[model samples]
Target: MKILLDTCVWGGVCKELEVAGHDVVWAGDWPEDPGDEEMLAHAYAEGRILITLDKDFGELAIVRGIQHCGILRLVKFAARQQASVCLHVLTRYGRELQTGAIITAEPGRLRIRRPDEKGQPLTCDIQGQGSRCELRRDGAGTYRLLPFNRGSSARQTASAWGTGMWEGIKGAGSAPGSTAPGGETND
Candidate 1:
């Protein structure tokens, strides 16, 4: 695969991808920053997947409707983990990358955004741990993160997480935290 690593990505990632037999370009190596839009354009023109830590590319692609081969946004990952995670993502979602899907890879989740046949953006979230846990808004307007047991029902897993964990979703607490298990806090 051909990849364009954004300036924010660790330079070591380029070497790792190269060792994995991928054609890699690190934007950090450039003499000057051509800016995000130009970088995105260059990646699109070259048919390379743009790998970045920036969220702006998603807005540019989804809101501005810019054309691109694909985008993989790695969020909150440490520099040492970037290369392995990048390879893992490529091994798993290479097809999506080839077809222009915007994928956000986070701690233990992957949020995939792609346009439907009608050009409407559709999102699919997959937990990197294996199974999926969906965040849904209830009729009462509260958000619940529903975890599922592999062979069982969603209700079964709810009890495993317990009510306190669920209650944490209601509003901001005295301290910043997460409702998801092993998840990162926003602040």
Candidate 2:
């Protein structure tokens, strides 16, 4: 994956992503901070996912409707915890990041917002763990669970549920208190 780490993200995250064979660019190493909007623009123009600890970028993308490849916001995570969660999400949600989405990772949970077929944001929350899980909302507004392939990564195992559930949001067991997705929140 090609990634752009915001100036606020821990510098160590860059090395971890690189070690995992991802192409990474850290804004901290830049000569100057280009400000959030410009940094977002650069990330979009370059087709890289922008990872930040800033909520302002979320406003820029959500309320201001800025075009972007993807944005992953890490909230309330310590500098040491950031890289591990970063790698975990990349492994589990790489496809969503590539295609475009605004994802907020807060502690053990993840809030993923993606453009629906009509281009309106469709938001979902995933929490829980144990085995790989698949999600779909039933007509009555309840989520129905199915099993995703245990052998392959979520992105690689993407099935027809693609339109309904997030392809492969796996467990966050690698991070403290993080678990496999078992629940969701519309808000």
Candidate 3:
């Protein structure tokens, strides 16, 4: 799996994935902050999954129509915690993510919307129109993020994250990169 990691994905996860050998690149390696739009564009153009910690990309993907081959947004976790969740997602669900999916990881729960899965697929009739889905971890089932906030006068907030199982990803996780992916070619 080729992944373009956001600045929020710090060293521990970076090292873990790098050692796992998944061809990962960092946003900070760019000449400057590539910004969400440009960063996402780079990932899409290169067929890489854009993994971000900032949830703003979720909003941008819908409102600005940014498309990415795949995306993983790690919500509300510290650097180490984020890394653990990412490792689990990549190790346990890497194959599931290959086909243009929007995956959100929030501690114990993970939610994703793949191109042809089933209920509530992102309406991406063409390429470069990203798949969109953000889910809150609910007991026994998943819940959408936007609909839960839309009816309120004040915006609702999701809870903070927890640490995850990190046993296997150390041995093999999706790391993806060589040249700085922001400007250089993915190869």
- TM-score versus the correct structure, for each prediction: 0.68, 0.68, 0.59
Clashing residue pairs found in predicted model 2: 127-182, 128-180, 129-180, 171-180
| Whole-structure CA lDDT of model 2 | 0.71
Model 2 deviation from the true structure expressed as Cα RMSD, one decimal place: 8.5
Question: Could you tell me how far off, in angstroms, the CA of residue 87 lies in candidate 3 after the best superposition?
Answer: 1.7
Q: Which pairs, if any, clash in model 1?
A: none
When summed lDDT is taken over every stretch of 10 residues in candidate 3, the lowest stretch is 166-175
Error of 3 at 53 (Å): 1.1
Score residue 40 of candidate 2 by CA lDDT.
95
Greater lDDT among 2 and 3 belongs to: 2
Of 1 and 3, the candidate ranking higher by TM-score: 1
